[model samples]
Target: MTALPQERRVVTAIPGPKSQELQARRTAAVASGVGSVLPVFTTRAGGGIIEDVDGNRLIDFGSGIAVTSVGSSAEAVVRRASAQLQDFTHTCFMVTPYEGYVEVCELLAELTPGDHAKKSALFNSGAEAVENAVKIARAYTKRQAVVVFDHGYHGRTNLTMGMTAKNMPYKNGFGPFAPEIYRVPVAYGYRWPTGPDNAGAEASAQAIDMINKQVGAENVAAIIIEPVLGEGGFIEPAKGFLPAIAQFAKDNGIVFVADEIQSGFCRTGQWFASEDEGIVPDLITTAKGIAGGLPLAAVTGRAEIMDAPHSGGLGGTYGGNPVACAAALGAIETMKELDLNAKAKRIEEVMKARLSSMQEKFDIIGDIRGRGAMIAIELVQSGTKDPNPAATAALAKACHAEGVLVLTCGTYGNVLRFLPPLVIGEDLLTEGLDILEQAFAGV
Candidate 1:
């Protein structure tokens, strides 16, 4: 067996020699608006290992924020994308459609949760998928209002920003946002105003009441939610919450949308997180892991709802570019052949065991929650549930210093989320967990 490297060897500290040089160049050449997770510039990535410019190989736990579920540079994904590039890159689907695009749509219709007749539209990014979902809802319902939940992140676009709940970086100065968008409380169990063990049904009832009272249900076109909130921390909505919301939407003639951008494609042990709850959404938005690492996203929904938008209103210049479609096809094949759903469940078992043990040893670990491979550990004050943002930041910094790449999330920025690629070796996963435990001890 080829031994995977463990115990981070810091050759030249975190950034090292080459990364520092590249960082300066990146500062000069690249747009400052785009943010980077780690300071080290990556040269290559495979499985769960990312090799930096300084020749430092680190375990990647963030998985490009849950994008590369099949792992970066999977053989099939690379081979298929390379072959497609040689054939042709673009000829927009609208201008002249290709078999690759149609094939991806067929796969999506078959894969996404729901047995209803489905239709799909492709887009260039997660935000684009989200934006189009909204347009489709509006066209189908002929309603002006859209309802989003608190701590929910839709996208960076102006309309999505208004639909999103976070205020700082996503919505700070960029609005005057789109009108008729509203926010209600999410079923976040932790930091829940009422109590810790509140039933999901009760939470959903309360939220539904708010919608009915504040924004009449008849006026609402859709309710968009993440089955498991991504950037707002990996908080899975309480059990029964999703089903209840779906029921309310159905009763009120509102479109129920599940934003599975971060939680889809076996990332959550199931094909889609919505499957866990048996909640069939009227629409599902997917991206991230959909096309391996290529820029692609999609909105798959009930045939009636998707068809509501006029033919000419729903595409982009490169929405279903052949290269991206090929990558997506390969990704789907990889997910099946590798049994990534089983791998995700296996990952969750290991994560729960390791992180639960860490919680017993570390007082800062307030809560450990998530399903399948999508897990998070929220840091808090020693004896209270107060968010310990400083300690969380310090722990992440320590992990990075030790050559492990992890990420922080949560509305208060006190949660460390683990989203390692499902293809990662058990030894590497354990080693990364060990690093996190040591970092917590040091903090």
Candidate 2:
């Protein structure tokens, strides 16, 4: 294999011939439920570019939906992962543990918010970590009810599906979901009915009231939230909202879980988005950027709470696989070596400025939000707050055709999220933003 160059070069159409052929095979053999944001299949990825099968090098803005935060193939990550692969791959952590797994857990304990005694359990995906967090919370508190916010996305598993707020693709017809899960209003300032200033106090008070009246605090096992809402369009909770909620949970003995699946690692300019507001959660669920591109996730929390589960209750056949643990270590190495938190902050400054300028120029670009490299723009009707999913789709399509990959998200499907790799070059990122501006102009 050759080294992937850090440049966007389009030698063929967006999908080209090879990708289209592969798409046909995928359609016939793969599940219809699995969806693709952009149909371009990649052969190699590094820095800010995804090289597809047809020899088209597209600037990546999605970072595989925030999975490849250190870039698709950071040198440190590849080196460590390759060494681990050469040694050995598996041996369930439960039956036989490895230093790599333990080391990753130690890193999580040190990196996650709160300096108090902490412990961690590993899993394969964010959903597993989240589900385990709830289970641990329930076991520790002896409670039955779980609380989540509107427009938040936890995962796709049966229990997480119940916890997730979206209905169409994530929850539609997937019902018979786990019981005792409750939904409450989130402090989404942009769309707050009473206006942004009142969103913080009002949403928190209403949510607390609902929990008290509808599901008593004694019955609540946990209150889970994304410090910066991920699939919910990167809507950071309004000021005073998260602290208020966290304090309420602490007062009532409810475990406060920060689902940092998409906002963790250096994706949000901080180790975790919870740090942005100085709110320390009782439990934190992390994945995505944790292990570069490998499948690894964890639930780290107060040692007492994490240890509540039975001895044999938490282990899984593949939880904390050695190779993935190695990859996570390497990813952390890259983060520290490059100061990706600072890089993410720089990206946030760059992107927010660019997107804010675009917002000034485009009436459809309603709001610019999110922190660090996880920024997004919500599309709305010309001069109103009404969501415009059609324009969102059109803009994304236009960018994809021009060899710049982007992603669309949110409950109304009106958000264009930009999760460029933290290691992306200033030139490539600026060029991608340029393409995005042109796409908006075309739209």
Candidate 3:
């Protein structure tokens, strides 16, 4: 794969003159609702750096919100996608069946958590996959209610907005969400009422009790969760938590859906985070890293559950676009060839060590958690557990100013998440962490 310079070179102020000029035009043309973290327009990006309009090369830690796990311009992804584009960009899979779509489904069936008879349907985005998973679950179970967890983030769609727990940016002023959705407590070990050791059992018991007393499991179609919560902070649910919930879903006939959008591909050490707890979900929603940079998502699950929907029940106009599917195949190939799973694990080892040391010095860092490359630090008050969103914001701003891309997310916005590309070299990773350390020091 062709590589970008594995260096952090800031030739100008963060949003340099050229970027500032573009920003002014963007301000007038783009809708106010659309938000951007770093406003400098990216002219080229690959490996671990993104070169902006003004030639500033920034270290990439966000990986385009975990969409570039195989790297932004993976050779396989680019080659296959480009070849497909040359042949035919879009015939619309719905209109004309394509080998690429079928091939991607075959791969997903083999890759997702379960070994049982499986099937898949592709979509344009993670939100679309999630929505379809819900639809399939309800259809299969002949039930209406869907259950999610606190500190969960599904999507911006009306249905997923109701599934998402946060309110401000995602759900503010946008109401009348889909009904029959219930929220339960997640096993957030760091913030759990009980101690971390007891968090799994406590949270599972509470969620089961709530489902029975309030939502009635018999009436529920699915229980969706992120194995390692994303955007809601990279909160890896306590060890036994996921298995307990999966068993509960099995016993109650609730379609257990793992929303692996942010945690899937090789972003986590495992191909799918659900595998970490050995909890084979009945349905798994995936996207982000699935197709390199191209938009693609899938709902892979038990064949019986997937076939529950009518023939015309699931599909989108542009679902599994040929080029995107080709990109997905190539990305998967690249992942296997390069063993990105091991790469993610190594990243975790490197980051955990560095971040743990940082945590020792910075008491504001309340917790460090996550698996593989999808790691994060929860910022809090110096001596208290109270979230310090201000500190988090300042730290991220500092990173941006110094030519590094870091993302902040959480219900309280007190999280700084690091999702570097799995292909990022150790040197770049170390450099980015150095920039993070400097940002923390300044903040």
Candidate 4:
């Protein structure tokens, strides 16, 4: 068993001489639009550490944007994926067929919420699964309108780009996006105009009313939302909000799709974030942590709804590639064996206690929120709710320089998020937080 050293040891400056050379190479070889939060290239990453080319052992808190929840190169994942690779990498599920794909879908149907008969289709990424989910919903309902909430991030595809709310990098200049897509207010408790207590009912009412009046619920196919907003700063929509909206969708024939791409697979101390709200979305899109770093996504839902798509209507060449499916099966085994849901809860306890203590000391941390390992702190000006993106940037830079990988995200770009792998040792997790505290002080 080759394992990471599970320690943070910076041998040189943040981006040492070796990494500097790689940066120059990347600048020329990679497209400028492709961005990286931390520029130092990784030589290997597993457990809680990422060893960069510069030989700096940085504590990983980002988890490859929540993809490595079972840990990077997990033993089970590597073993299973390696076995599949040896047999064959791809026959393409759409072209031929494979047991691996069928097994993964069976697992999804069994694991995902709802007792009803369910079915799933695999895809290469979260965006593709989401697009297909929308396709299935529209086909089933015979409607064209799709509703998404504010601060929701679907993907970068033409349809998903229209679904995503952010403008600067995701949507700006990329116009003529897919039409019949409508946006509504999410129950963002922190920044809600009315107040957190009333955010659920008020926001739900507003959203339902808008869908009925503006988009016409009769014409709406799906109402897609993230149970815990990911890039939108890990905002957990207020309690009662998801349920109310789900009921409305049921009243109409609209599919309530939960985009659990970032908050699924034990990341939120549950099989899926929707489970927190007792929301069994008619269709659910999953990815990110599904395969322990492998590229795989699934749209799991009611059997009838999924069957609405014709035989050739919902598949891609690389959809449900055997290697990825094998990896997903391995990841599921690891999750059950390790009881990662409980591990994620423990992480939440540790993080919330530490971050709440920090919040008392530092006024810049306006709000510390999120469930399980998926947590974040919204940076703000002292004594006010004013967003402070500058401070957010400075703090993240400090953490990076000190060999702790932290990521920043928000509609205003003023929130710092922590997504350490569930397999991280307590000592390493604590050390990462210590570095984060030091970063805060320095900033």
Q: For candidate 2, give the lDDT of residue 17.
A: 97
Candidate 3 residue-wise lDDT, 54-161, digit = tens = 999999999999999888899999999999989998887778898999999999999887679999999999999999999999999999999999999999999999
Model 4 bad stretches (over 4 Å)? none
Model 2, 1-443: lDDT tens digits are 12688888988888899999999999999998999888888889998889999999999999999999888988888999999999999989998788999999999999999999999999999999999999999999999899999999999999999999989889999889999999999999999999999999999999999999999999999999999999888898999999999999999999999999999998989999999889999999999999999999999999999999999989689889999999999999999999999999999999998988898899998989999999999999998999999999999999999889999999999999999999999999999999999999999
Per-model TM values vs. the true structure = 0.97, 0.99, 0.99, 0.99
Worst window of 10 by summed lDDT in candidate 4 = 1-10
Candidate 3 is scored at a TM of: 0.99
Regions of candidate 2 where Cα sits further than 4 Å from its true position? none
For model 1, which pairs clash? none
TM match of model 4 to true structure: 0.99
TM-score of 2: 0.99
Instruction: Output the worst ten-in-a-row residue range by lDDT, candidate 2.
Output: 1-10
